[model samples]
Target: MGQLLKWLAGMLILASLACLALASWTYARSEAYLRSFERPPPFQLPIPDDEVTRARGDHLVRTRGCRGCHGDDLNGQFMWGAASAPGLPQLARGSPADFEAALRHGIGADGRALYSMPSMGFLRLRDADVAAIIAYLRSEPVIDRELPRRSLPWAIRWDLARGRDMAMPAVMNRVPPLRLEGEDSPLSRGEYFAMTTCNECHGLTLQGDSAFGDEAAPSLAVVAGYDEKAFEQLLRTGKALGDRELPRMSRVARRRFATMTDAEIDDLYAFLRQWPARTTD
Candidate 1:
C-alpha cells in the first residue's frame, strides 16, 4: 500500500511539471507573435470640421467603446486599469492617419501588434465615419499619461498559444469587408449601427456567440422578439425582458446607447427586426 501511494504521488508531480512546461511554452510563443506584429502603412482620414459629422463621430466613439479603454477624456488609460495590461497611448496627440491605423489595424505607432485593442471591432467603420472619428479625436483634450508595460497572465497566454483566443491584428484581418451602405435608408443605417457596435461583443456576423469572453450572448435574432418599446428600453437601460440587469451590456447601455436619438433607435430597430431573415437567406 505504501509503494502504491508513492507511485501515485510521483505521477502527480510529473503531471504538474508537464503543465508548467506547457504554460511556459505558451507564454513565450504568444509573446513572440506580439513582438513580431507588422506595421501598417500610413493611411490618413480627412479630418472634417463639420459639426454634424463630428457629432456622429463622437457618438460612434462612445457606442463603439473608445471611452471604455481610453478614459472619459481622449487620453490614455491602463487596459481596464489593470496593472498587467499595457497602458494606452494618448490619442489626442496622434496624427489622424496614425490614429486610423491603430484604430482599424491594431498596429501601433511603434509597430507592435496590440494585444487587447480589438481593432477587429473597428475595422468595419465607414470611410466618412472613420474621418469623423479622427476629427473628434483630434479635437479632444490631450492627456499625457504613461502606462506600465503590458503583460499577459499564463492562462491568457495558453489560450493564445492554442487557437482559442486570437490577437486583434489577426482578428482584424479575418473580418469581412464593410459595404459602403449610404445612409439613405433605415435598413442601411441600422445595419451599420448593429454591425459596428454589436459586433464588438457579438460575433462579427451579429449571430451572438456562446463563447464571447465569459458570456453567452444570445443571437441578435432574439432582438426580433422585442417590440420597439421593449427594445428601446433594453438598449437605453440594459435591462432584459425579465428586468434582469446585464453585467456588461447594461453598463455599456448606460454609458453609450442610453443617449441614442429616437430616430436612430427607430432605424436600428427596423434593421434588427429584419435581420434574421437576411441571415437565414
Candidate 2:
C-alpha cells in the first residue's frame, strides 16, 4: 500500500507539471503574437461626464455587444482559440478614435488590424453613435480585472504570413462603402446605427448569420413579432416577447439597450421592423 501511494503521488506531480508547462507555453505564445504587431495611434477622444451623453453612451455600448467579450463590468476577458487558433485580447482602454478604428475598422490600438473583431459589419455606424460608445467606455469605472493572455494558433499565423488569409487591416478594408445621401431622415439615421453596430452579430442582413452558429446572434426581424411595449421590455430588461428568458441577448439588452432614448428606440424600431431588400449575386 505504501509503494502504491508513492507511485500515485509521482503521477500526480507529473500531471501538475505538465499542466503548468502548457499554461506557460500558452502565455509565452500569446505575448509573442501581441508584440508582433505595431501599436495604433494614441487614444485621444474627449470623454465628457455629461449626464445625458453618459446615459446615451452606456445604452449604445450595450446594444452594440461591447460587453459580450469585454465582461459585464467592461473588464477584459480572455477567449481561447476558435478552430485551433490562439486566444485573442478582448479588452483594454482605447481612445475614441482608437475605439472607432477597432469597431469601425477592426484594427487594434497598435495599428495592426484586428483579425477577430467583426469590423466588416460595424463599419456602417454613424460618427456620432461611434463617439457615444467611446464616451461610455471612457466614462465607466476602469476595472483592472486580470484577463487571460492571448495567442494566435500557428495555422492562423501561417495563413497571415503566407497571404492566404488577410490581416485584420486587410479584412476591414473590405467594408462596403457608406452611401448616406439625402436630407437626414430619422429612419435613415436609425438604420445606419443598427447596420454598423448591430450587424456584427445579428447578420449583415440584420436577419441572422449562420457563420456564428449557436454563437450566432438573434435576428432583429423577429422584433416585428412584438408590440412596442413588449419590444421595449426586451431591450430594457432582456426579457422576451412571451416573457421567455434570453441568457446572452438579455444581458446585452439590459446593459446597452436599457440606456436608449425613446426617440432612438422609435427610430431603431422603424428601421428594424422592416426587412432589407435581398440582393443578387
Candidate 3:
C-alpha cells in the first residue's frame, strides 16, 4: 500500500507539471499575438464642444453597451477583475485620435490592439457619431478611481493560442463590411444601426454568434414575429410579449436599449422586419 501511494503521488506531480507547461506555452503565444500589430497613421475625430453633440454622444454610449461593460460613470471597471478576464478601461483620458483608433480600429491608446473591446460593431459607426461619442466622453466628469490593469488568465491564453477564442482586434476585422452593397434606402439607416449596435451579441450577419457558451444567438429574423409595439416593449422592458425571460438579452435591454428613442426603435424595427424576408428571398 505504501508503494502504491508513492506511485500515485508521482503521477499527480507529473500531471501538474504538464498542465503548467501547457499554460506557459499558451501564455507566450498570446503575448506574441498581442504584440504583433502596428498602429496606423495618427488621425483625429472632430470632437465637438457643443452641448447637443455631447448629449448625442452620451446617448450613443448608453445605448451601445459601453457603460454596461465600462461602468455607468465611464470609469474603468473591474468587469472581469473579480473574475480572470481583463478590466474595461476608462475612456475620458484619451485624445480624439486615441478614441478613433480604439473605437474604429480596435487599437488602444497605447497603440496595442485592444484585447477586450468589441470594436467591430463600432467600426461601422458614422464618422459624426464617432466624433460625438468622443466629445461626450471628453465632457464626462472624470471619475477619480484607479482600476487594476487588465490581465488574461491562463485559460484565456490557452483558448486564444488554440484559436478556440479570438482577440478583439481579430474579431473586429472578421466582421462583415460596414455597408451592404448598392443599398440606398431608409432601410440602409436601419441596417447601419443594427450592425453598429446589435451585431456584437447577435452577429455581423445578424445570424448568430454566442461567445458566452450559451446557445447560439438566435437570428434577428425572429424579430419578424414581433409587431412594433411588442418589439419596443421588449427593448424597453427586456421582457418578451408573454414575459419570457431573455437572460442576457433582458439584462442588456435594461442597461442599453431601455433608453432608445422612438425613432431609433422604429428604425431598428424596420430593418429587423425586413431582414427575414431578405433571407428567404
TM-score of each: 0.78, 0.65, 0.82
Model 1, position 157: C-alpha lDDT score: 70
lDDT of 2: 0.63
Better of 2 and 3 by lDDT: 3
**What are the per-model numbers of colliding residue pairs?**
0, 11, 0
Across 191-274, the per-residue lDDT of candidate 3 in tens digits comes to 888988888878777888734334567888889889999999999999987888786788889888898889888888988898
**lDDT score for candidate 3 against the true structure:** 0.76
Query: Native-vs-model 1 lDDT?
Result: 0.74
Candidate 2 least-lDDT 10 residues? 83-92
lDDT tens string, model 2, 1-281?
99999999999999999988866665555445544555445445556657777676676666676666666666666655742111112222444665666766666656655677666766666565666666566656765455445546766665555456655555444454534435377767667767666666676666675233247777777776888888888877889888988867787677667877798777777766754532223
In candidate 2, residue 181 scores what lDDT?
Answer: 37
Write one digit per residue (lDDT tens) for candidate 1, span 1-281.
99999999999999999988987788778877776667666665556788888797788888887777667675656654332232233453456666777788887666667667767778778778888877666666655566666666667777877767776787776666544365578888888787778887888777875223457666788887789998999889989767879877788888989988898899899998988787766
Q: What do the candidate models score in CA lDDT, each in turn?
A: 0.74, 0.63, 0.76
Summing lDDT over every window of 10 consecutive residues in candidate 1, give the lowest-scoring window: 81-90
Looking at model 3, which ten-residue stretch has the lowest summed lDDT?
81-90
Answer with 2 or 3, whichever has the higher TM-score.
Answer: 3
